[model samples]
Structure formats: C-alpha cells, structure tokens
Target chain A: MKMTPKAVVIGSLLVLAAVVFVAVILPYADTNQTVPSEIFRSRVSEEAAGRLIYIQNGCVYCHSQSIRKVDWGLGADRIAQAGDYVEDHPILLGSARTGPDLSQAGGEHPDDWHIAHFINPRYTRPVSIMPAFEFLGMDRVATLTSYVQSLGLKAADRRMERQRFWKQEAIKAYEAGPEANVRWLNENVPQGWRDVPNPYPTTEAGLARGHVIYQNFCLGCHGPVGDGMGPAQPWIYPPPLNFTILKGREVSGGVLYYQIMNGITGTAMPYFKRELESQKIWEVGDYVAVYFINQSDANSEPRGIDAAWEP
Target chain B: MSNPSPTYQTAKGFCLTSAFWMIVGTLMGLIGATELVAPDLTKNIGWLVFGRVRPIHINIVLFGFVTPGLLAAAFYYFPRLLKTELYSERLGVVTVVAWNIALVAVVLTLMLGYTQGREYAELIWPIDVAVIVVFLMVFFNFIMTVKQRTEPVLYVSVWYALAAVILTACTYALGNIVWRPSSGALVGIPDAIILWFYGHNVFGLLLTPLSAGVTYYVIPRSVRAPLYSHTLSLLGFWSLIVVYTHIGTHHLLQVPVPTWLKVIAIVDSVAMVIPVMAFLINIWYTAKGRLGEIHADIGAKFVFTGTIMYFFVSIQGSMMSLPDVQRVTHFNNWVVAHAHIGVLGFAGMIALGGLYYILPKVTGRPLYSRLLADIQYWLVLIVSIGFTVVLTIAGLIQGNGWLNGETVYRILPQIHPYYVTRASLGLILVIGAALGFYNIVRTLFVRSGEAVT
Candidate 1:
C-alpha cells in the first residue's frame, strides 16, 4: 500500500460508490416495488397541506408513524407495512415515540379533541410534554389535525365515522338537560357493569392515589372542582362532563368505572383502558363517586371478593 | 514542529468559526432539553417549538461546530505534514466565509420551518447544495496541497482528512437527493433506506474519520513518538470505510425495510468493532507509558478521553443494533444517550481537542488562559456523561413501561425528573460552549503582554 494522493482520493471514492450501490441502490430496488396497502390512499389536498405543516413543525421527531410488532401502544393493532407508505414522498415512519404513534391516529378522537390537543396538549392530556401549538392559529391547527386524522388512511376513516356518530349522540344527550345526560351516560354502560360496585373497598390511601391519577389524567379537562370548567373546557364540546350533575342520578360506581375505562367516545374524553389498569380505573372512579358525586357504592352490596391489598 | 508559513489565516478563521458556532449549537440543545422538562416554557412561540429547534441543534453541531473544529486542525497540519504552505490562503478564507453564510441559512430556514423534514438530512435542497459545494471547496484545497507536497510519504492523518471531505461531499448530495429539488427524498420505504444510509454515514464517514484524523495527528506528536503500528493504521483506515458504510441500515432495523438489508446492517454493525478497536488500540498503544505527556497537554487529554468515549459509544452501538436490545433502545432516549456519547463525548470532544491543539500554533501565541481551557474541558466532559446517564435512565423507564403496556402519556410524570436533570446538565454545556468561545477569541485576538514563542 504505497500511500499516494491518487490512492487515497480515488480508492475511497470507489469504495463509497460500491457501497452506495449495494446498500442504497439495491435496497431501493427491493423496497420501491411495494404497492399500496389496503388502508393506503392518496392524501386529499388538505391532508397534504397538513403533512407539510407536520413536516414544518418537526412532529416526526417525536410522534412515530411506524408501528412494530412489539409495540403495545396506540396503532399496535396494525403492524406497519411497506405498502402503507407507497405514496409518501418521504415516509414519516418516525424514529421516536415521544408521543403516541400517529399511524392509526386518525379517527382516534374527534376533530374537536385534536383541535384542543394541538392548541395545548396539556388541555386534553394533562401530563403531555408536547408543546402548545396555539401559535399555529385555529386554521393551521385544524389543518394539522386533519393530517393526524388521515394517519391510518382508510382504517382511520372507519374510526372517524364512529367518532362522528358518537359526537352527535353525546351533543344530543347534553342538550337534553342534566337528568337526560346522566341517564344517557349510565344507560350506555353494559348492564353487568352498571350492576357491579367498585370491587375494592375504598380507603384513604386509595382516594389519595386516585387523587394523583385525577390530577395527572383528568383535572386538565374535568376542572379542579370537577365542574368541567378546566382550561380546555373552552375548546372541547359537550365539554368534559359536569360531575356534580350526576349526583343522585343513578351514577353508580360501576357506571363511573365503565365511563372512565371506555371513555365517552366522540367527545374529548379518551379511553383510559390503554393507559390505566383495572385498579386505577376503579380508584379514580371511586374518587369521583365520593368526592364529586357525593355518592358511594364502593364495598357495598353484591361485592364479589375482598382484595388482599385493601387496608 | 515546522512553520511552513508565517501566517495561518485559514486556520485562524476556522478556529474562530468553530468556537462561535459551538455556543449557538449547544444553546439550541439546551432549549430543546428545557422544552422536554417544561413544554409550556416557550408557550406559543412556534419557531422555538421542539421539532424545529431539535434539527437546528443537530445540524449546527455536526456541520457548524464539529466539522470546522476538525478542519481548523487539518488546515494547520496539512501544510505542516506536507512540508509546504497551503495551496491558496485566499480560497481557504473564502470557504470559511461561505461556510458561515450557509450555517446562517441553516438556522434561518429551519427556524422559519423551511425543511425537508428528514432527521440529519433536514436541510432543504439549496442548503444541501451549499453544504456539498463548501465540502468540495475544502477537498479541492486539500488535494491541491497534497499534489504539491514535498514529503513523499503521506501521513495517515492526510488520508483520513481527504477521505472524510470527499466522501461526505458525495454522501451529502446522494442522501439529500439533490436531483429532486421539490422533495429531496425518494418515495415510500426506500426514502427511509436512503435517509438512514445518509444519516449514519454523516457520523460514520464524516465525524468519525475527521475526528480520527485529528486524533492520529495530535496524539503521537503530543507524546513525541512514531505511530505504534503502520499495519494497524492501514487496517483501521480501510476497515472503517468498508464497515461503517454498510451499517447505516441498523437504524432501520425495526422499520419495514427488507430483511436482507437488516441482516447486512446488523452484521456490519457488529463487525464495526474491527475498525473501532484498530483505531483505539493504535492510539492507546502509541500513548502507552506517556500518560504524563498526554496529561500535560490539554489537547491530548481531551482527545484521549474522547477515545474512551468512542469505545463506550461504539460498543453500545454494536449491542444496540441487536434486535433484542433494540426492542428496548430504539426510538427512545437510550439511542439519544448513545448519540450524545458519540457526538458530544467522542467526536465533539476530539473536535475541541484538535482546535485547542492547533490554537497556539495557528496564532503563534500562548493560550489566553490555561485554567479556563481546563474548565471548559471539565464542563463538557461532565455534561456529556451526565446526559448519557440521565437520558439512558429516562429511556429505560419509557421503553420498559411501554413494553408492559404503559402508555407514553402515563409515563411522562415518571421521566420528568430525568428530563429536568438533563436540561440542567445542558445548561452547563451551554456555559461550557460560551467559555470556550471566550477562551478561543481571547487566545486568537487579545493583545497580551505575556512572552510570545
């Protein structure tokens, strides 16, 4: 290896060219052949514009659209496919999950939830570290929401339909007066859940733990006094429920648990089943029952079994 | 040591450019880290948002801070090694001016949200071209210097410096997809393949080799010894280019990229130990029984510590590429920690080392303050290690929490403490950058009454 200027420059250049062919050219040949996935469709102009905003804002750095088989978060139902990104100029299969994967994020919530979320993620997600995008203004925020809603493509559309339907139902119930709203809320719970009481006996520790969960997950939307006057109240429609109205209106512990776990879909309320375990749901439900509703069905009548941990 | 010329205008220009940008780059990092702790700190300031600030921080550190620092050392050494003067001092100065202009454009466009949206490759087509053109300018100047060399045997540092500039020029154009001005990306998954290929190479070819060039040049001279092994140098240089170029796909291992490509990236990533150990062994052995000399020189100390960081980061990289380990590390702050170690701890440390090593020689003056230089070194070293430890813990908490079905939202509160600690450390790093700039400017510009060599 006689060291020469020619050898160093030309030799390294040749190595780079060859590697680019194999690592870059060959893989491009293989992956570029993929057709559209079933959920894949060309974005509408609005969605495309929103994609630009997403790009501009650098959302891809934190919110990944790429879902792996090992993932247990949102969009875990569908493993990402090469076909899924056939139309993306620069596929936004993001590298980090600082936030949830937006692959199937479209239709996960109604557009209203997204709007409120974009303005200040803390409004809807009290614990969110995502920066407030209120500076993007209402129009850009709406556009950004559309792009997020278009994440799962056709799969997202189906979810959107469900959200719209639920949104209408929720608004109608709210307009029907507090009695009707409480009745509709509890009526929606499965009969078995409606009959079941909070399984764990309520204790001071449980309430304290439940208080922490409330502040972390609910206080932003539901308000400090649980009157649904939280900061996000102005943005959300059929706004976060006014818990005081549910008092003495057949709001059982099970109804509270069911509502918390399943969430009032179509509104800004997101399902907690993905995040909260059964105990957390029960605890938070108990907290709401005792503190907000001034009612308690916990550890009373038809209780199946006492948990060992109860003190 | 030899002074081929009385004036080193190009080296001085680059030394100043590196020092100035280091503060801006570290400040951006501090902003991004602070946002993680207090998302509402910036409130409605859209331009200061996390997404935009993050890329600006990364690009500036890579191109603005680290590259120029290494180039400053290269400019000083190229002429010294060749036993001749630089080919064109005027051309070298113009490149410095153009490089700073491009860096300004990088900050402005990204702040205004003019980006291609790809990490590491985020600069739009125009900035990308500017980057390549400037790199070409550097390569042309160096190669011309090589052509007119009085010395027959080209030093190992010369090889690395030349290869890094040329290879980065080509890779920058290719990865950025300079042909496609509208998007600067390929369609579909291939876009990801190309992006990581270019992304990993940014570190693999650009930073690693440039840092290696500085390390190879500075250490042996500081220790007053010939290289421990010519065979090891040959083995290290060629193996680095070969193995590093193949492993960029390791970033896409968890993605929907082809299985065969993933296999290649994994195997090559693991095989990367060959080049890494070769370089480290060569340098460590060269410095053997010469700890006192290395310690006495502020520059050699930083470079040597950088080698230790490189060893940790590279080993961590190899292990991380494993599918099982990636299940926990990928797409999280563990990778962030790994990156901090590689860029800030390894290459960044070496860049400062090279800059410090050449500062007095370029200016023909003593350092403005030895104590201040030592303080900057300690601040940087502490910040890098602190970031790695804090971010890795946060990443593990997130990764493990997610694996057991904990939502990202549920775990935010748990990691807030670590994020706070990271931001606190980032503040120290910014202070370090500011102190370094102050030290460098004073050393280069201040008229001191002290004796001049």
Candidate 2:
C-alpha cells in the first residue's frame, strides 16, 4: 500500500471538481424561479431581498414553501406543482420541521405578524421553537417577510389582494367602535353559518379538555377573555374573531366546529383538523359554545351519533 | 520513548463509564420509540411525554453516551498510534463526569418541562453552558495529548478528532446563544436561522467528523493496509466542513429568509454528495480487497457496518434537504427516519464499533462471547433498517394525507399500523442494547474471559 503524491493529487482534484460542479455549476444550469409578470406581480424588491435572507438563515428548517392536495383539508387553498417553482433556481425545499409549513403564508397575516414572527417566534407562538431572525436587522427582516409573503406565487398574489381589500374594510369597522366591528364581522359570516346551532353536548370533561386545547391552540389568536384582541390580533387584519361577538347569537356546534376545523382561509383562523383530532374539535367547539358564545344548542335534537363515551 | 509503565487502569475506568452511558442511552431510545406508538401507554406521566422523553433519549445517546464512548476509545488508541501515552487520563475522567452531570440536568429539566422546545436544543441555558464546558474540557485533553505525542506525524484520524471537538465547541456556544439566559435567542427570524445552522451542524459536522475519524482509524488498521490515500482523506475532511457548514440553511428554505441564502443552502446540500461519496469511495475502496479480513475481526465487522449506515444517512440527508423531496419528508417521520439513521444507525454503530475494537486492548481480555457481539450487531442492523422503513412510511402517510386536504382523523387508522411496527422494531434495538451492556460488563469485569482462539 505505497502512497504516491501523483495519485494523491489526482484524487484531491477529482473530489474538488465534484464539489464545485454541484455547488456552483449545477445551480447556474438550473432554471431559477421568479415572480410572474402576468399577474400584477409587482415584485417588492424588499421582499425579494428578504427571501435571500430566508435562504441564508435556514428558516426553511422549520417552515415549508409548498402546499399539496393533502393540505386542502388542513385548510390549505392550493397544492404545489412544478409550475409554482418554475422561476426558482435552487428551490427552497427545506428539511427538518421544528415549525409549521408556510407555502401559502402570504395574506395569512399582515406584515406585522411576519415582523413579529421573524423577530421572535415566542411573541407570536408561545410554544414556538422557531428562532428569531432579529439579528439579521430590520432591513433584512423586512426582506425575509417579503419572501414569506411571496411563497404561494400567483395564489399568494390573489390572497394578498383579498387581504388588502378586507384590511381596509376591517380597519374602518375597527375604528367605528366594538358594536360596529362585531356587526361587520357577523355580516361576513354566511347566514347559514350564523343560524347554525351547536349540536354537540357540553359535558364537564369535554369543557375541561376544551380549555386545555383552547389554551394550546386558540389562546394565541382569540384572547383569554374571548376578545379577538389576542397577542397576534394587532398583526392580524379582521383580527381574530372576538368570540364574544357570537354571544347570545344562534352559533351552533357544527358551525363552531366547521369554523375551527376549516379555518376561514382568507382570514387568520387557520384550520385545526391537521393538528388536532375529531374529539379535540368537538370538545373545543363545546367549550366556546358554553363559555364564549353564552348560548349553545349542543345537546339539542339531531345530535348526530352520540360518541361511545358520551352519556 | 517510554516512561515508567502507565497502568491500563485509567483507560479501563473511562471505557467502563462510556459503555455504561451507551447502554443507558440506547434503552432511552427504545422507550422513546415505543412511546410514539402508545402515547398514553406509559401512564400518561408528564415526565415521560414524547415531547420530553424524545429529546432526552436523543441528547443522552448523542452527548452522554456516544460521544464519550467513542472518545474513550479514541483517547486510548490516539496516544498509542502517536507513540505517546494520553496527556491526562484524569482530565478525560473529569470530562466524563461533567458530561454525565450535564445529562442528569438535561433529563431533569426535560422531565420538569423546563425546555426551550427546540428540537435537539431543548436544554435550558445553564445546561447549555455545562455542555460547552464538557466539550471544551474534552477538546483541551485531546489537544494536549496530541502536543505530547512522541510520533512526529499527525494521522488523518487525529485531524478529524481535533476538528470535531474544536468545531463543535464553537457551534454549541453560538447556537445556544449562551448570552441570553432567559430566551437563548435573537428577537426574530434571524434566530431561527442561527439555531438550525447550529442544529444541523451538530449532526453534519460534529458527529460526522467523529464517526468518520473512527472509520478511518478502523478500516486501514483492521485491513492491515496503509491508508489508500492520505491526500484524498484530507480533502474529504476539509470539503465536509465547507459544504456541511453552509447547508444548515437548507433546513430553512421555506421561511422568509433571503432567497440567495436559501440558494447557497440548497446548492451546498446537493454538493454534500461530493464529500459524502468521496469519503465512502475512499473507505469502501480501502476495505475492498480485505472484506474477509474485516469479517474475521468482530470489531472491524461492526465498524464496517457503521460505514455503510453512514452512507445511507448521508444520501438520505442530502435528499431530504432538497425542496422537492422535503415536500414529502419535512416535518414528518421521514426526517425522524433520517435522525434515527444518523444518530442511532450511523453514529451509534460507530461508537459501539470503537468500543468493541478497543475493549480487548484496554481490558487485556477477549470479548465474553464473539457470538453474542455478532448477534447484537445483527439485531441492531436489522431493527434499525426496519425502523427506517416503518417510520418513513408513517411520515409519508402523514405528509401526503395532510397535503391532500384529508382530515387528520382520517389518516389515523392508516398510520397506526406503521407505528405499531416501529415500536416492535424498536424493541429489537432495546434488546440489542441490553445484550451489549451484558457483553461489555462481562468483558470488562469478568475475569478469565474466553478468547477467540
């Protein structure tokens, strides 16, 4: 096993070339994803710059940029495809998920939520293990938010458009006092949903479990007192639904269950079906029915199939 | 070149402690895996929650167990190969104790629910500091031993061992953000970026280097050949550091971070195959003509298997880093598949191999039973492969189900079967760990041990 300098040098060069080919050359040959020109794609240069920051910081470790057919029931709007990343050079598909996916993150929240999340995850999500990007500076943070907002591409543009439209309306109603704001929010809920009565029973155990679920999942959005003014409310446009608004209304178990499970997609109320179970949904709905709405039809007629454990 | 004979007693002491940690850590892994299947099976105790126990299992195996176990073997062999006795076995023992103390703190905090909640970085700031101290101590001991070496030439293994300790120490400090006791973070998105960079590096650079170091030492030594190519070895070493360092950002591609940074991460992640394949080719080639020789020695057999696992993990890791591939794998058991393959499959195998290789030399006695070690090895290999398969399927089911807009409840029945299978496979690993503990104890403590001859 005699070692020769020539063989050694040749081996080193081969490995070196291989590294260079993949790291530099391959990326150049690949088609890079860019914003579409057809859809009012005004590329916020700042957001584009922030996308670079996202790339640099490894935020993809915890977040994802692609939604799929599996995500629709989880309240996702669209599934990702090759066309979505047509302009991406080194597509931002990340591994390791210490956090949630963000493919359709645009218009999910206002720029303020992005800012808060980027600065420190804990401020937005009490249990967030996603680290803060504040060290990257406000300029960089702004760029990263822009990139996050651009995740869904054309779909994101549409959502952002909706968000912008509703944001103006929300602000106006918010400025007009709580009564007017509640009225505006209820007006947005389809009449059927507004009339739907709670169907599940409000058992003590169910309410207890619901309290825990609410704290873990909903408290961050709907405040402890059922006021929409949760920590994330400021950053959320049409802020979280003030649960109190539904008080004495005809809100039902099915409606609350649907809202909680499906999430008002164009709004900040994310679907919980993917993260929570059926029992959890039913329990949380019951909790809101008894505690927040102050009126519930949970245990009334047409109670569906009574769960095995229920009396 | 020799002073008054140093007793093998010091080396013996470190070996015993290391073997203990290795066995305990593996048991923890078994428990953690089982818990995933039957969440409420363990009395629903807060201390044993998957959230708490999983991290403890991982941390103990990585820090308390594998690192020390491998370092014990490294310390014993590094000095001998360099024609010098260890600079201070006492310091090595102290580091071992400190590491165990850190493990104790980690388990306690996790059980008490005092976690930062980040995957792998669960320990609070104080424990974080303890970890840094332990790493620094280990590094200082290794460096001083190298300085005191009688051998003029530094081997490739020496370089890897040195780089592992030094780089890991720095990464730990920066990743933990030891300065911020309350939060251990920067204010926002930048912090997530920094945290994962350090997190992935823990596996990518630190564990990778240490395992590779042992592989380099074992392959040639067992095959009775000079290293195939020292220059290639060094090249692989440096390239690993370069590519692995930046690829951590690949973990954050989906975030609001800069696209350019994401580009670097994705590209580097793909480029990772270069260093990965290079090392694999070099090692596999070195062992090519001597497969019989490798099989003949039980120690080399384990080490060889470890190298193969390393190949699987690295390839899987690279693929998992791809955005397209991540669409299916991220946030699912697929990454968990990668984690177990990397930690338990690759690093765990390497640590065990190092321990077995050095045990006879350190104890002056043969293994209690070659058959037992062989059985243990097969058990670990088969079970881990099964784990990889079962967990990957579960992750896929979850990923695809969620992506399809299917309700989470709908997918439960589909995924439960895989969970059961994974738990069953985990039991095999647990059995192997227990058997390993018995074997090591017999070899170390039992007198008149049976010899291969």
Candidate 3:
C-alpha cells in the first residue's frame, strides 16, 4: 500500500514506454502505410550519392526538408508525409535549428544558383549566415547542389521539368539580344496584369520611401542606379534588368509593378511582395519611374473613381 | 568520525562571486532586450547596437555570468557530497579569473566586430582558446577532487558534473575547430557540419549536463532525503551521452547531406526524450512532497523552477527537431525562443539557485536579505515566462507568413507589436537583474548586517 519512490519511478517509466511505443515506435514501424502523393518517388542514384556528402559535411544543421500547412505561408507548396521518408531510417529531422528548412526544396532554383549559394551564401543572399561551402570544391559543390535539388522527390522532378522547358526558351531569348529577351520576359506575364496601370501614384514622399526600400531589398540584384548590375548579376543568367531601357517605352505601370512585386521567377529578382508591403512596392515603382525612366505616373492618376479615400 | 562540517567555508568566495555575476549578466540582458525593441533606445551609440550588445549580453549572461556561477556551486557541493575538499581551491579560483578574462575578451571582440560570425561561436579564435583552457583547468581540478574522495559511493550528481566538464573540454574544441584558427574550418560543407555539431552540443552536452548536475546535487540536499533512484539517474546520464551526440546532424536535414545521417539525427532527436524525461521524472519525484522545503530555501526554489523550465525546453526542443514541427519553427525567432529557454530559463535559473543556495552557508551571515532574494526570484520567473510567450508568438507569425508566401513586408506589420512587448518584458528582467546584482554585491562586501529574521 506504500507509495515508494522505486514503485513510482517504475510506473512512470512504463507509461513513458507506452507513449513512445504508440507515438514514435508505431509510426516508425508502419512505414508501409505512409501516404504517398503523386509527388512521391525515390531519389535518383546521383542524388543518393550526393546525400552521403551531405551527411558527412553536416548540411542539415542549417537547413530542414519538411513543409507543413503552417509553412504554406513561407511560400511552401506541400506538406511532408511519412511516405516521403520511407527510405529514411534515422530521419534527419533536426533539433537545433541554426538555419533555414530544406524539406521541400526541389527545383526552387537552377543548378547554377545552388553552386553560387553553396560556394558562399553571402554571394547570393548578401546577409546569409549559412557559411561558405567553398572548401567543398567545385566538384563537390556541384554534387551537393544536385543533392539539394532532389529534396522534393517527384515534386522536384516536375519543377526540374519546368526549369528545363523554360531554360531553352530563356537561352534562345537571351541570344537574340536584350530587346527580344525583354519582350520574352514581358510576354510571359498574363495579359491582364501586363495592361493594368499602377494604382499608386508617384509622390516625393513615396519616391523617398521607395529609395530606402530598394536599398534594403533590391540593391542586392537591381543595382544602385536602377540598372540590373548588382553584385549577384554575374552569377545569374539573363542577369538583372537594365531599367533604363524601359525609359520612354510603353511598358505599363502594371507590368513594372508586377515584376517588382512578384519578381521575375526563374531569375534572381525574388518576389519582394513577401518582404515588402503594398505601399513599399508602390513607392519603389514610383522611384524607378522617376529616377530611371524619367517619367512619373505614380500620383498622376485620378483615373479610378475614389471609393473610400476621395474625401 | 569527525563531524561533516555544514559551514561549507571553502566555497564561500565562489558563492559571492557567482551571485555578483548573475546580477551583472541580468542587467546586460535587460539592456539587450531594450535595444531589441526601440533599437534607437540608446540613440544608436556604438556600444549599444543590437549586433554588438546582444553577443555581450549573451556571453556575459551565459559564460561570464551564468555558467561560471553554476560551476561555482558544483565545485562547492560535489566535493562535500563525496566527502572531500576541492582538489585545490587555488585551481578553482584560477579558473574563475581565467574565465573572467575570457568573458572580457568576448565583450571586447563583439564590440570591435572581431567576430567569427556564428551565433554561439561568436567569440573569435583566441578567446575560444581561453575557454578551452579554463575548461581544462576545471576538468583537472574536479577529476582530481573526485579521485581523492573519501566517500565509498559516487553519487549521480558527481557523475553528471564530471561528464559535463570532460565532454565540454572535448566538444568545444571540435565545434570551434580550435586547431585551425586561421580560418577555423576544414574547407566548405564539412566545416558547417563540424561547427553546428559543436553548436547544438554546447546546449545538449555542456549546458544541459552542468545544469542537470547542479539540479541533482541540490534536489536531495534541499529536500532532506536521498535520491529516489540512483540507478535511474545513471541511466539518464549515460543515455543522454548516447542520444545527444549523434543528433547534431538534424540541423542539416535540409542540406544535401547523406540520407542515412539525417535518419540517424531524427531518430536520436526523438530518442532524446527517453534520457531527458528520465532525468526529469527522477528529479521531480525526488522532490514530490518537498514543495514546502523547496520554497523555504530560495536556492531550492530556483532549482525547482529550473527543472520545470527544463521540461518545457526539452519537450519544445524535441518537437522542433521533428520535420513536421520544424516546418513551422525553423529559421524564425522560434529557435531564438528555444535558445533563451535553454540558456536563460533552465540554465540561468539553476545558476541563480546555486548562488543563493551557497550564499548563507558560505558567508556565515544569512543572505544580506532573504526578502530581496525572494523578490528577485519572482521578477526573473515573470520575465522569463513573458519572454517565452512573446518570442514564440512572433516566431509562429513569421513562420506562417513565409509558408503562405505572404511576403516578408506583409509579415512585419503583424509582428511589430510583439517586438515592442518583448522589449517591455525585457525591461522588467533588466530591472530585476540590476536589483539582483546590487543585492548580491552588497551581500558580498557591505558591512551592514541585518538581524536574521
């Protein structure tokens, strides 16, 4: 009848054992029943080979591979499933998160981007703490890039397919000169967005705010002069845009806003819509219009009937 | 047999010094928190930039302030429990002085931006060497002390304390790449692995063990009872070593590392609960009916609360390590939350406990004021809890925004208010830290003595 310490400890251990058996051990054993999506598949042999280097070097320390419903806001696509880890035994679900997650990282960028990033995160990200893998050498860096590219399994394959398809078009467009390439880029934007006018107008205050925003967010690629000659330009193909060329051209405000806000995908111009606000986007667009293009339509429009702010 | 002396005089100096550091560290932490919110709270003075001040705050609060403070307690008690004099109080003091020097170097390097640019490993290489040197000195002193112990039975607390010192001596060297100071790396990808392997272990091995060692030592003594199960204590200790060592690879799961290694990391991270909970259950049970005993002793109160914080931190740490859990926690302030919880909540609390536990006995004068100590205890508890809530909410918002492709700009407005709240809570901790430091320093050197009440 006595509640001895020994008895209490033993009983608690039993409960813990039961909990682990159900929560951890059971799921691990039932790997077969793991739900596989259309995106699920095994890693290619090359990717598998690259994984060895990943483990030996400790890449997982800074990155993670899984994305969840909550992660949809992080620009994530799909949630991870048990089937995605079917081949995994120990599972590299990291604890001490010193860096970003990598679970669903497939075809997010081209192979070259990985190389430059792996060589030194700062080269691409400017302020990254991900550490330089330059010592991994070009050959190993290439191998590491391959492994990182295979993170999403079949999902990565689709992205890779898209990249391959667009790469040919992009290369051909570039070969034809900047005029053809700019046309090719603009042509890709959906028709509606291309014709739309920038709703926000250019104001002095707006232009100043845009200048600050551009320095913090876009200066890494879009040069200080509004030309695409930022530090990361050489590393990126089709480089950053030369905004001056759009001067006096009939490029709609909507087109410029779309490119600035959404970023030209498959290029180094990452979408600033996530890091910047709508006001910031409008301000920066006005800045480019005034400084680079020598034009200002930002505040010029009384076009749309004021619904709420007309007072 | 000669009566075992209860005065515990030899460690009196350490008790005084540790208390002083706790107060100083907390003050720095408060200032650091203020800077986080207003940023220009100090008008952008070079000394107060978040970049410079944050590292100093962390180091002074951690190494300069907390770790040494805890080690002092460990030094005093481990020898007594084993029925031995510290192998050399002389060596102990030497370690303390050397540790202070390293901390000074940390503040200077951070201020000068002579940083290695890693989070915990921010101290440049030379100071890193000083840390290793201090560890070696402490290790030598403790191991010698244990070897000469008069007690026939080695308590679990001693085992943990010894393991913590020895492992830190090794892991710190490996993690910092102390050998190659020029670059402090092995080229590319391997360097990242090595650095993080050391980084997480700083928490898992060094801080965890030392904190647990102090807890084990203080629990039974404060409760006036023998440990519930010495066997379970040892099981927890050894299993911690087994599971914690290989889990470093979990940090790299998103990289192009080998799948097998990542598998090892994830499994072990989950497996970590076994050892973690083992220690928690054993300690919690040891003090089950001793709530009054714990509350009666300010030191025990800190340790008891620390044990609870450990429960939250370890569980959170385990969950964050999971791929599913990490999807929402990674690269955000969530990890920062874990860091503070582990460093400040769990380790920092125990460090204060260690100081208070030894203060009365060492000074032979009741704490300059038990009332002040109790006040400090509440201030710290409130501030720490506030930090956990605010930082966690901010992390969730940032993580969710990124996942939804909500754009970084859009997320800033959502979390700005949380940052302001965190800064305000930080001010509370800062005030508490200042009060604690003043009380401790006054206790150590002031002549005025209040009647023991």
Which candidate number maximizes lDDT?
1
Residues B1-453, candidate 1: write the lDDT tens digits.
335454888988998999999999999999999999999999999889999999999999999999999999999999999988888889999999999999999999999999999989999988889999999999999999998889989999999999999999999999999999989998999999999999999999999999999999999999999999999999999999999999988988878899999999999999999999999999999999998999999999899999999999999999999999999888889989999999999999999999889988887777888888899999999999999999999999999988888988888889899999999999999999999999998888877675432
DockQ of every candidate structure: 0.89, 0.08, 0.08
Identify the leading candidate in terms of TM-score: 1
Ranking of models by TM-score:
1, 3, 2
Candidate 3, residue B183: how far the Cα is off, in Å = 2.2
Q: Which pairs of residues collide in candidate 1? A: A106-A149
Tens-place lDDT per residue, model 1, A1-311, is 88698888999999999999999999988987898888988999999999999999999999998888888888889999989999998888888888888888998888988888888988888889999999999999999899999989999999999999999999999999888888888889999988888877889999999999999999988998899998888988988898888877887788888888888889988888888999999999899888988888889889556667666
Which sections of candidate 3 miss by over 4 Å?
Answer: A1-311, B1-13, B23-35, B39-49, B448-453
Candidate 1 to truth, TM: 0.99
lDDT of 3 by residue, B145-260 (tens): 77677886667767666767767776777667687785454433344455566667777767788888889988889999888887678678768876777677677665544566
Q: How many clashes show up per model? A: 1, 66, 49
- Give residue B245's lDDT in candidate 2 (0 to 100): 75
Of 1 and 3, the candidate ahead on TM-score is 1
* Docking level of model 1: high
